[model samples]
Target: MNQAVRSEPGPVRQTRFSFGNPPRGSVAVVDTIEGIECCSEAIEDLAENAVHPNPFYEPWCFLPLLGASDRKRRLRLLLVHGTNDDGSGAHDTLIGFFPFEQKLLHPLCPVHCLCPWRDSYRWTLRRTPLLRSGAVANALATLGRWLVAERHAPKILVLDDLPGGSGIIDGVERWRAEDRRLCHVPDMHESHLYRRQTDAEAYFSRVLSGKRRRHLKRLRRLLEDLGPVRVADVDESEDIDRLLNEFIALESSQWKGKIGTSMASMPNGSEIAKAILKEAHRRKRLSLLTLRVGDRLVAARSAFLAHPGCFGFKMAYDEDPVYARCGPGFLLDQEGIVRLHDDGDLLGKDIEWLDSCAVEAAALPLSMRTEPLPLHRYVVAVRGGVSEIVSRRFHRVMQALPWRIRRMSAF
Candidate 1:
């Protein structure tokens, strides 16, 4: 077990939070980007052994976001460390890593809360923290106790967009069960997931209806009639900047660009994305696929690779009226599925599934080709107070409202 240390220049203030004497573990808070960089080695070790993999939380993807100049919120990291069994006092093993932000639950509401950190660009899709396998329960307990002991801790802890069946949920449940004072309200919704159970042909045949498959075939034929259609994987040796520029340009030509929501439109967005992709490529965790008609690129998909799982991060398709009928995006998805199952060198044979990383409405089109994975959001009272009562009542009111209204009023 490597000793977690902060070796960055200047005074490094480490604050410890605990209930009574430290039991088997302890929690340390690091609020600065430099402090986080100093613990990169330990964090990377925790990522490798985490109970579940979250590519967005990995240093390669997260560090660059922290350094982005346009970032609005201050992010703080909670580091949970496990102590050795020996009598010697040494908190040597890194057990958990949770990055969060403190803010008001809503502008209309006065209740301050702690939530999983999100960047101004909204790139992170998963909020699950990296907890060392086999130590999830202890890590959760340590974190909970720390929250309780901290003098200025928020009344509520809201974790949103956590994938269903995540260990974080189970650990939180166990901790809540032990501490009955904590009140929790959890809500779930479905997302898209693709598991590679068999060869692509067989898998698609099993999931896609005959009529739908025929329609896709017809669409492919239409594309072929226009020109030669091919699905190609971006060569790993190609320059990352050039590939990213192409992707950004393609995305900016679509509706996102018209609405001023494209990556190229956001402040410092292109630079942050380039840094993230460059780091991911350097770490061998990037996979890019494209669909081209003759000489023109129509659709492209980018995914991040974590061992045993891949996350579909960003995708863009030519929105030209000419190519709309060909369903270039769907064609690209079909090809991507084939490559995931057949092109071992591209995605690696070890990867078992691909998470679309999209919301239910956005993922509806892929429902036939993929399975529905539930995602959850939980609002829990870390320490009972006026804020807790207001939050619980607000949640109850939202639940009683219609789905659309609830969504509109969501915190």
Candidate 2:
């Protein structure tokens, strides 16, 4: 616990919902305001509706949502509800969102999770007509104000928005003037988007070194010598079990993975994959991409349609050292991206990119998502003058160690 950090105001409150404000807790509680339970379902819907091929946030990214709210007593979540305009009526829709309180789980992470002051949690709000700007921002304010009285409060609040909309720029402007105690996270909502000429092509062009291109080109040309090659997308079918099993097999072989290898690295990973496929057909924007040379299927890619954007995942390519010269892995990826670009089903006006990396391909921009999903983390602190001083000294000493040793050392 850090003594320098203190509690701050929560979000704005609205009485119109007819829901009386729940009893405010003395300690921060980060619980779902809305859409937390259905996040994964929402991601699947987005993948099915993407007009252009781009990676959107996946629901699984919010796995921490399943955690207990009080675990991090100092952390709190503020979920702002967006309103949508529909012919039936205007209703609250889960729209653009960003996280409020964030704390680094492991201060020594070598990658994105490394920062000592990582307050930016997963936050999101719908980009479509599903949610309105004023309502969401007001709700966020209400939530912030509610946390003001807590004995232990979050030191920083992370806010994220795509460069353009989400009403975040304006929201931040309003949020700053209201409270000085709450600090904003730097580079909070800056997101990244990668582009290719076509959606069906492999997106790794950015990462493809000149030497890699030369080698890949020569390899492809050699593979072409074998015969005329072809690529295709898998059609929707009730045979999801068959398709998934085949996909897992193809993916494992392509990556030198086996029953006990990476594809099955985590029991939950395979379960999530299977669950996604089983529910794919039910979702309009969700689809999978696969590449084959005649009867031999060399690779497969899965993507979710997030209305204006799509999120691609689980890409695997079979590697037969015998055909190593062909570069089936690269070929499959290229074909998948190209196909996404060409697919008529994924075109729409409000086109946008979501998620930092859809495929995690070297070519992916490795940028943050345009909008941040509202996720929460709990923080606990020591109180009183002596406790505060000791806490500060302890935190400084703790953060000074190498990341690896710190992670393994534990709190």
Candidate 3:
């Protein structure tokens, strides 16, 4: 079993550092939401021009979360800045944004560590830092150097759910090569990713086995027998508020509600969902698909658009026996994938792929219709101290635990 942290730890001490002989860039640590808000404009700029897009990290979604978090006081924001154009000594250009939370290694012990900031809601899937285009290597190097230089810094740094082929892993590897004191240990797993090939018909034919195709067809037929079935996609003219409410209701009527895991059931869960959806809608980066039978909404799925890629966020379906037998969830997923592949005007022509964002076990069915993309969690140890050795040993023990236990211990 994992050690439970009862008392909250103190905030990360704020610090600033300027890198390079002539000072090429600098890193500033902000430990409060208010402090982070002061840099909102720069943060948004960095997000817009980031080498990789992570809608989860965008200010619209992130700020509200930080405001609602119970551990907001323990959160830290690392802002990396580059020198301005006027050749003045001022560092105005925001090159990177990395958010972290300070936590105790164990409740009984005082050893502290830093992990990527995540809400207790567990809604976000990606944790990659926002790095400006053409400055990824410098940003990563500056971050590494700052961490190493901190006198009271935590020995362990944990970054979870970093997608594969995002260039971050390579950058980390190079940083480690340059400094042998940082022990980099990574754990990898695969998630489902859908990349459009030919047309929807041809693509599905190639990915779906004959048996599975027939089974799905049978399910669709069964669903239609109840009432006239139709698929709908949320459009620019649609009422987002009503649709979002319907989604929450439809989702809450199933097992999630009984288990208190549904948005409507959890504390502030519905409000958070609405806020995220609204933000995405306002930015014209939201995609919602629903399946209906004779006016009754059977299933719905939502995704956030980060141009060139989409991240599947959530999905829900009616579980009443009458509709459950028809597999409305799977049907809706098929329809969504079909539309995503065929309807260019709907998701925009720039969209290239969709990440299922489902865990390995939950992604098995999706894997049949999509490619596997590896995702990783990196646990790093900053050497040269007894605390570092303790952190390394702690991780070694944790790694020896069973997968289920390890997952439960993850925070």
Candidate 4:
């Protein structure tokens, strides 16, 4: 495992409240981002065993995001506590964790857009032990209260990129059902990337035309003949530095570098990626695949491993498009996918799903697993007024508009 990364000391604001039916436990509001900033192992433990596992929730990804955000944005963490029946509140266990950005609320403006700093809206709750019945729903109630009462965000909270039948979704629905006049609409969109069955070789063979498969095979052979070709998966702390350098250099050679968006082109982007990779490495949630000829890296991919799934974080290939014509990136993907299906990782975690975290109309052939991923923009008003009427009308109009226009308004 990589050496643990630490966050700089900062003032953390906190408040506690007892919650849940039959007194399951307390829910704490963490106004500052300090709670999970340095707790990689704790968050990893939750990711592995949470009621609904989201690989992106790993500390490696979110903490770096928290650090990278401009201080102008308000980041808060909601923590659910579980403990013994005694009301003393001693030895409380952390039963749930979710982070949120407090939106800028203008009193007269009902037409404001609801958007997160980054794509983080998952309410990750641990499975029941103390609260044996409906733990997920219970946790969401606490979180909902925190969002409205503490953070003072619009009652119409916009949650993004949630899978159907997720516990968080259930919890939100449950709250809406019980709470007075609480309404939510689930907006669905197709994320072109989803999970497929295990056999990589079989899937690849079935997807490609015979002639195209042959061409890829021939190109693979040609690339191999260049020198001693090898594919390596690095998870230990040792090889992360190599992965970072090779990936940045490879990606920089592409259009993203010229546009000043690639990691190599932006120093802040590079550091956040580095911190996330290193911390994820420590918790054994990172996988980096390198395709090399002799000692030269030809292609590389960085991914996060967790919760019976793998997420495609980033990818890069050789600078020369002559190599691109032959699809060196595809070659790396083929090798890496096969290896993952064979073993998953050193621990043999069943990597059931490969979440592309990508949009519709993508090129990669990720066989559909569940329903099309729906990116929802939920809005609920605190009370009926010009605010509620204007907010609903604006959101309805926005949703009815063309996809491009609606997307532009979201920013």
Worst 10 residues of 4 by lDDT: 121-130
Q: What's the CA error at residue 410 for candidate 3, in Å? A: 4.9
TM-scores of all candidate predictions against the true structure? 0.90, 0.57, 0.90, 0.78
Number of residue pairs clashing in candidate 3, backbone atoms closer than 3 angstroms, sequence gap of 3 or more or interchain:
0
lDDT per residue as tens, model 4, 1-411: 012223447665556766555556566555556755644565566555676565555565666666656666666555566643243333265656655555533333434433443532111211111121235565555545544453344455555555555565666677778765444555566553334445666656655667877777887987877788888777554667767876788788887688876776664666666777777778777778888888878888777765566666777788675566667777776666566557645423576666666557755534322335544345545445544565556656765778866654532
Among all windows of 10 consecutive residues in model 3, the one with the lowest summed lDDT is 1-10
Off by over 4 Å in 4: 1-10, 19-26, 35-45, 82-93, 104-134, 145-153, 192-198, 205-212, 235-238, 344-348, 365-377, 380-383, 386-391, 399-411
Error of 2 at 372 (Å): 16
Q: What lDDT does candidate 2 reach at residue 396?
A: 57
Ranking by TM-score: 1, 3, 4, 2
Show model 2 residue runs off by greater than 4 Å. 1-136, 150-170, 187-192, 196-217, 226-228, 253-263, 343-401, 405-411
lDDT of 3 at 112: 78
Q: Give the per-residue lDDT of model 2 (tens digit) for 1-411.
A: 111222224332212121124311111233433323434454334334322222223344333322312344322333333232121213333333333334443334221111111112211222221113334344344444533433344422333222344354455556545654443332322234434333323344544556866876787777677666666555564366777787877766644365544444544555655655555445555566665566666666666555555555566666776466577766655444444455453422233443333323444234212223332221222233433343334445556877765664212
Task: Name the better of 1 and 2 by lDDT.
Answer: 1
Could you say which candidate leads in lDDT?
A: 3
Per-residue lDDT tens digits of candidate 1, residues 158-265? 767667787767877877788666677777777788888678888788778889889989999999998998777766678768788989899889988899878888
Global lDDT scores for all candidate models: 0.76, 0.42, 0.77, 0.58
